[model samples]
Target: MTETTIVQYLFKRLHQLGIRSVHGVPGDYNLVALDNLQEAGLEWVGNCNELNAGYAADGYARIKGISALITTFGVGELSALAAVAGSYSERVPVVHIVGVPSTISQKQGALLHHTLGNGDFSVFANMSRSISQVVVHLTDPTIAAREIDRVLRACYVSTHPVYIALPTDMALQKIPSKGLETPINLSMPPNDPSIEADVLDSITEIIYSANNAAILVDACAIRHRVIDEVHDLINKSQLPAFATPMSKGAIDETNIRFGGIYIGDVSRPDVKKAVESADLIISIGALKSDFNSGGFTYHTNTKHTIEFQVDHIKIGYATYPGIGMKSVLQKLLGSLDFHRIRHTESAKSKPPRLVNQEAENSGGQEITHSWFWPHVGNWLQEKDVIITETGTANFGILETRFPKDVTAISQVLWGSIGYSVGACQGAALALKETDRSRRVILFTGDGAFQMTGNEVSTMIRHGLKPIIVVINNDGYTIERMIHGEGAVYNDIQPWKHTKILEMFGAKEGEYMSYAVKTRKEVDELFQKGNEFSKAERIQLVELFMPRLDAPRALKITGKMSEKLNAKMEDTKYA
Candidate 1:
């Protein structure tokens, strides 16, 4: 039997899963293990910080199906906690590998430099357990291969982050390479036939009996890799398909049966009526988080909703446990009687056009959210990877419609402020490896950009070309709309946005930067044949808008959030 080192086995597993690049900042403990990344045919994406690395890994996973993140124990691992937690909340598959102290040192309880002055080495892993689907500490080399495979399987199957503590001393420990011959089982467990058939019958009965039916697609549809099945159902059944905030581009917006985004009360009037008034709504992989559901404002009756989730199926309040969505969806697609089903027409009203009355009437050069987002819909190309930050850009993008095959990455459920910039780097790199021609576009607010702006340097370092649009609204516009309209805490120090690429080490021809305050400037820059539109080189555009202005959806959601916060305070004090 051939023998391999522990790190080699781990990297090979990740490579087998199609993870071409690993994201992380190198630390002392993880240094030796990093050597095997190249040997396993994986490129190391060295990020600016561990937190940014974690965010990048999350984004890469969103694009490439699964990704790996490496960080040293204690301080390094803890810095990535926020990103890892976001992955857990949003169901992104990331293998978070933390290099820990040597087995002998950990056993002897030696106080390490990154430790909390005490000898308890398990503290960091303990902190991560709640956020991870599985936490495995690889102390014994004999079981390290088994544990690694187990965690990787869990991460892929569960579609959530998993933690593995790779001890420094065990990095080079010999492990049997025999297990590598048998690939990890990525298939979903087979659902019980009798229960699945009954559930399918119940769903089909509802569909056949309903006057009007709709399909609501959410994040888990993409995460669990059942998008093909969802699309098949939508096409064959001809039901009006709608995507949630987190699942913006799951369905082609141009499809005749594609209803607009359904965000509860914040949705467009047509979308709201189409979804809420449906006699039967088949919600596939629905994650009804507060923000995703417009502050829990969904008026759709549960009795009329049939939810197909990763683990089970829910038909009119009756839950069928253990029946996964993938197999069930495939089976459902085949069983659906398209001829007998009543297919309702999708809401015909499209999103607002690019023509902005406010800008035209005022003749003001300032780009407003209403104009910018709609204009973005027209400028986007097919198969683009769009990353929106969790602020004004996140909400603003809700108004835009993407071209076919475009992947929109955002932290709607997690709502992390600065996730987009780091995610842009990771996503761009993932696209570079898989599909180089696909453009990666980022929409981030100025305040959010400042949080993870250093990741742009990593992009430049790796020759990843992505268009970075900085929405320079002067401060945190999203925060201002929520509570502190003019509060000092919501403000940020202004920076010269045009010089960012240069400051990040992009030399003259290596990048291009533009400052566009007017609607005309944006139109001209986005026009065909323009250097920015060509995207041959890295491009950064500083988009200027009114500091107090925000997306229509943002205003509604923000006010709702403030009222909820106030009500919570009242309840606590009363």
Candidate 2:
């Protein structure tokens, strides 16, 4: 009942912000906050570790646009930073709240758990400054409400990571009523006004003039929830549309306007030739990151180039589009004289090829990631979700066919390993709340799995039965490819695959594991997973295969590394 209790005040503010779940583990510094969470209508989502908790929060925010997490200082905060960095890079609005020692304790210079014997409360906060947009310490009740508003604005408006340090004493302090008040309107980015006409005119000119024009989009277009409009723009313009690796599901693959994924790293030579020869390029909601651009910049010599974003338009040739992609596309569609405009022969043309009735059919390739994904894609339910980690799964899924009804999500920016397991946990939880029959399927490598495999316990405890598929290729397959031969350092220690269920204390017959190698075994495991998903149990399937070929990007990187090695050898003893 004391007014100075910090946890009570903090919870009041969280409730005002409409945050229901605070994902993290309970620790000495944060116990008081955890105790007050239930009363504030906030559920404590306990994960196996802080890293998992951070990933879960990012997953939630991916769906909700904003979410929160709590972790203890130092080790917990440091572990959680990976996910925060991921959110920052990917533009997810995830708020990270870390618990620290009280002001009095810090003044006394007392040793703390997981600390580096330092008495600085800002140590953890400072470490996160590189990735987080804003890092603040909640030590003063007078400025508590203002700080909450500031951090919330930074997160919700910019859609980035924001960190708040909660000292033990501050969590117990009482807050003023104004600090807990909900606002009727929230701050958001507005479309650029002055440049709207210029953007439309420039794009119109390019479309009117080009022999072959194409729009290449990446993950941000999907993350910002504006892919639908971009799709409409491309379709209405009658222009060919291609997507980067992370932007696969932005439009239905079967759409006639849709072109196959463009992999600059391992591009099929034909695709690269098409992009290079194009006269006009419009990149909407796409980031020109190294992973997407094949390490070389594009549109350097293209006569017309433009980028449409939420806030402004950046044009490459002469004029910039300041209008939002959605608004500009909507206006263009409204004003489009479809009868007068004819798509160029080059843009409308397709190479001679056999058209298969079963476009989604898996290729007849045994022991390949691309071959396995299409079969799984065919089994997806309307509302089903796919969670993939970095490496083979990320790049492989780019070419894998997905049903129009299913949603796919993965970390596109930070590309952290071991993120899929925890993200699946959060996605499953979200699906449960929406009264959706959707299920979560996780694709992870064995090496990445070991990093945060303990997160399976969270699923058991929370009643989340996501189908976990562990690709057991022995070690870091991507690294081995990057370094070529004699890269034994990429291997991971073997695990007792089937014994994981017992180790996690899961119920017998409820938890199952399979070591799959042949095609027959792969089909059996899928059938088993489908059967177990209906029942109330966790299923982990271990897939065994040789160190197979990875995605095109990895193959390219590995080849580049081999060339560097050969060059070094030539210089040896000189």
Candidate 3:
């Protein structure tokens, strides 16, 4: 038997899961556990704090399939709770390991410095249960490995975060290493053929009879790790596919059958008709949250829609329980004849969305949002990682069309400001470790960047390379658009954005920085042969624009924001 401590076994489990780095802030309780990370051959990414650590892990998981985050008891775990909540809502799998007081101390009810001045140590663990899919505490050495396996396997199977409360003493306790011999079985329980066949036959019959069929995809396709199946279905069916805002980069956007992004009323007239008028709309991995669904304004009737979800299949009002989407789709794609349905090639195409001349032109010293986003769109390279902040940048990015293999990372549902900066550091490092050729590109507002600006130091410390574009509009333009147009609170003091690299620790000429005001400067930087086009080191470019300037999509979302915000509070039973 390979004898190993609980902490060592935990790290080995993470290694088995393909996690190369563990992100967190070392605490007194977790310090002993952190020692085992390196011993287990896993790198430690000490973040500025636990929250950023959690966000980094989330971003890393979005790219790397899974990630691990470590924190200490009460204070540390609570601080990272918000990030975990975001992971839960967005379905990103991150194993959160929180080091806790030793079992002996807890048994004796000893007060801890980070605790609530009380002897009860169960408060934080109880709170963590709300957001985690699985919660395990390694108080018993005998069951520690089994508990780890259970939690981690649930994490991968559900693709959700799990919490492990590791007491200091238990971390060092020896455990039988036999669990290390076999990999965790990530497979879901075998599907019942009777249930599976009925669901598959139902879906096949519907699609076979439908004349105008459409496919609507969303972010869960990416989360569930079925994006390849999605692409394969698209290729096999040759039917029109439309992505919600969260699904922008999920499919091959350049495909002829790909209609366009559909956001309720904001959708282009052609996309609106293509999706809304379809006789059958198969929405795979569909997330009907208000933002992705345009304030719940999807036009397709339930009778005409078939939804594929993680554990169930919903056709109209009927629910087939226990039939998983992964298997259902696989079976459906295999058995069904795709050409039985009609094609969308004959649908009349609408003219492309028009932009203001001033937005595209750089003749003036002032940079407008209209010109900025589309220009940025043209500059996006294939396979580049794009992280946009929650404000105007998120909405602005919708205007850009990504090339193939591009992975767009954003906290759209969470809409956390300053998330992109911290997430960018993690995503860039993830790409660097996995594929050095693909680059990480960030689009964040000045207000958002200012909140997590310290992340630059961490990025530099790790010797990572990411190109950060700071959209300087003088303040929180998104807030102003939705609520306070000219309010003083929406404004933020300006900082010299490009010089942040030097502030973080870059030697002279070690990296590139640019502060561009005119279109000419932007064009020159994005031109094919420019140094900014290639990132030999961390590149920071600050684009100066008017305070009131905002993307067209943001303008539309702003007007609807009030109505949507009101609807958010509507009771579920109402």
Top candidate (lDDT): 1
lDDT of 1 by residue, 1-574 (tens): 7999999999999999999999998999999999889999998989999999999999999989999999998889999999999999999999999999999998889977999878898889999999999999888889988999999999999999999999999999998999999999988889999998898888888889987888999999999999999989989988888999989999988787887789999988888988887888889989889789999999888999999999999998899999898888888788777899876564333543444456457766778987788778888898988999999998888888778888999999999899999889989999899899899999999999989999999999999899999999989999999989999999999999899999989978889999998888888988966678778899999999999999989999999999999999999999
Question: Would you list the C-alpha lDDT of every candidate in the order shown?
Answer: 0.90, 0.71, 0.84
What is the Å distance of residue 343 in model 3 from its true position?
1.4
Candidate 2 residue-wise lDDT, 263-323, digit = tens: 5645545566666566777777777665566544343353466676666666665544334
Ranking by TM-score: 1, 3, 2
Residue 96 accuracy (lDDT) in model 2: 87
lDDT of 1: 0.90
- Candidate 3, 1-574: lDDT as tens digits: 6699999998999999989988888889899999888888899999988888888898899888899999988888998998898888889899999999988888888976998877888989999898999999999999999999999999988889999999988888999999898999988766789989988888998888888788888888888877888888989988778888888788776676777778887676777777888888888888877667776678888998899988888987798878788888888878988668677554323323334455555456567887777677677778989998988888877777777788889887888788888889889878878999888899999999888888888899898889999998889999998888889999888898877999889878777899888878887888864677877789999988888888877777777887677666675437
Can you tell me which runs of candidate 3 are displaced by over 4 Å?
Answer: 346-365, 566-574
How many steric clashes between backbone atoms does each model show? 0, 11, 1
Q: Look at candidate 1 and tell me the lDDT of residue 482.
A: 92
